[model samples]
Target: MTDRASIIAVLSALAIAAGGAALGTAGQVPQPAGDAPIIIAQATGAQATGPSAANTFNRLMKRPGSEPNIQPSKDGIHDPANPGTALLQWPSEAFAGFPRTNDGNRVDWVKTLAAGLIRPWTELEDPEAEPFLMDLTIVRQVKGSMPNVVYPHLEHTQWLDCTNCHDEIFVPEKGANQISMAGILLGQKCGICHGRVAFPISDCRRCHSQPKTAEELRQLSEKSSWAKQ
Candidate 1:
């Protein structure tokens, strides 16, 4: 009799659970307090204007810009920068394996190698500060392929403003910009400036001396923000 009672109780509990699940699936159960509202609709390919549409719902997720609301009626959102440190990160043999970047320099690879063995991705290129006196493209220190960190002076000056790379972004190169692509891209040379203000070095060929396509040329062009790091 006790075994039969236990079996009956288990069956009753299971029946109750099934009924609750059915109600929940039918969208009849009320959501707990403080949860985001649920959306029930089919997503479309093209644009959709109605509130129930997925596009409109996605717009709700996007936060507007930080600027003050000029017109209360306008519901524009501000876009936030990508996640990753504001500071740039470049390739290191300790991380990428085999060797450091192809551009040979006077960097001390022994300590860098040691650090890499202990912490595979630990070592980064922080080149020594010697007097750089040459006109070369500036490179950032982020990770990417295809001349990742490259910058030319005359062209950048054409599109950017004076304050774009003054005392803030880079120290004046003899009142004229002069740095090497190797150091900058490595984050030790020209990255001293472009890494912060100009577009990140992760986007390669944007400032390379040799660009094969028009789109790439455009990517190197001045963006709206001065600080895109």
Candidate 2:
């Protein structure tokens, strides 16, 4: 395999390991010196210089008329392509299986789930669905205009238990999670779990960190994103 492919493979393995460890046993995987040693960190330590905290998007601060959940189609969200409300909302509640909003088109997402919703997974918990409740297309809320990559969620999930990330770090839908860079820098949302448990954002390369190839960059571009503006 090419070097980039190798790197990707290793990184994938690390995520599986970390997330699995956190999920498989009791909820307490040893942290990696504040930031776990995912392959991204293996590339460099620049992440230590960036935002070490993670934040869940808060709905109260949402811009008026913003899309509010994942599975946007379900919530009647129209065109997240524009920067308006799209940027302010959590990317989860709109997911297909996430949970429907009180409006009847949305889903109860991570934040809602955490705030207190008790639904089991459709995968391991239930044989009626796939391994995960939310699909990549739905779960990933990356923006195209941002300079950063889609948050290293899959990777971080490796070390962090689902409960640590989901339902807390961010809600499945927009606005409900309450993640803000300002709040994250202060230790909320993604920061709440990542700052001390998963790899700290102190390293610029961890989240904003990039692959060593143009192809990888382009590939990431096609995925979910919030940097499009």
Best by lDDT: 2
lDDT of each: 0.43, 0.47
Q: What does candidate 1's lDDT look like per residue over 100-218, in tens digits?
A: 43223212233444354433231236433222223455554332224334446544443345565666656865435445657777675447544554445543454553433555545
Against the true structure, candidate 2 reaches a TM-score of 0.28
lDDT, candidate 2, 128-213, per-residue tens: 54332332422323343334444544434423455656665567665476445677778877676445544455543445543335
Stretches off by above 4 angstroms in model 2 are 1-146, 209-229
Q: Which candidate is the best by TM-score?
A: 2
Candidate 1's TM-score reads 0.22
